[model samples]
Target: MGALELLPPDTAAVLREAAARTAGVTGLVVNIAVGYGGRREIADAVKQLLRAEADKGKSIEEIIESLDVDQIADHLYTKGQPDPDLVIRTSGEQRIGGFLLWQSIHSEFYFCEAYWPDFRRVDFLRALRAYSERNRRYGT
Candidate 1:
């Protein structure tokens, strides 16, 4: 029910419309990334954090001394959501390509040979099974 992206004006308008339409139908929430990149996301979050703290009458030194991960997390686009447990990489890609960089610190990844268009339900099942078999250490 949310999106993470540096959206174009038109796209932002469309997203707003969609969100308004889906306001209260809340069994499952889906997040889609359009023009999204992790480094940019972090940069945006930092800008937002600075503005918010400044608005609260906090000086730069005060903000710096009190700054923590939670403050940054609060400004991230995916503010209220849990980090992903599994990320199935399609199209035979073996790297994360900076997807959800800050949030995916403890996620499990599955690389599939098929491209997104060619991916099927069985492949999804295989990815799920692979994830289920792993002993997630969450960085111990």
Candidate 2:
């Protein structure tokens, strides 16, 4: 009866419901892509884009013109969610490993040495505090 065992069904239900409920929003979204693969996400996005275009009777050229990074992002599961203010990776992982690769373009990142299982509220607060103190220049 651990977290994993208690997760799948509720997670699936919530995600399905979110997708259904937000079918018309077509704006910001927040996808909690736990256990998600970056490459697979991109592939799925492309496939979905193709299907949507086919459904709309749009030509490939027209679709391509509309399928820039912003459009692709809009089509993502987490379309409307604000890009993260800060992405904190615990346990000192140096590599991003493709988590939120597109959304985090301008995000501030913090790496910590505490393992996730051992993470504490204070650790999170520290990360937030650090983020709050930084002068974020979005590629100025």
Q: Which one wins on lDDT? A: 1
What RMSD value applies to candidate 1?
3.9
Give lDDT tens digits, candidate 1, residues 57-131. 999999999999999989988898888888878889899887888998999999999987698999989998999
As for candidate 2, its clashing pairs are: 28-79, 28-80, 28-81, 29-78, 29-79, 29-80, 29-81
lDDT of each: 0.86, 0.75
Give the C-alpha miss distance for residue 80 in model 2, angstroms. Answer: 1.8
| Ten-residue region with minimum lDDT total, candidate 1 | 1-10
* Predicted structure with the largest TM-score when compared to the true one: 1
* Residues 1-140 of candidate 2: C-alpha lDDT, one tens digit per residue: 12233467977677678768887886544444466766666677778878888799999988887777776776665566788878878778987778777778898998888987698999988998999999999968
Stretch of 10 with least lDDT, candidate 2: 1-10
Against the hidden true structure, what lDDT does model 1 obtain? Answer: 0.86
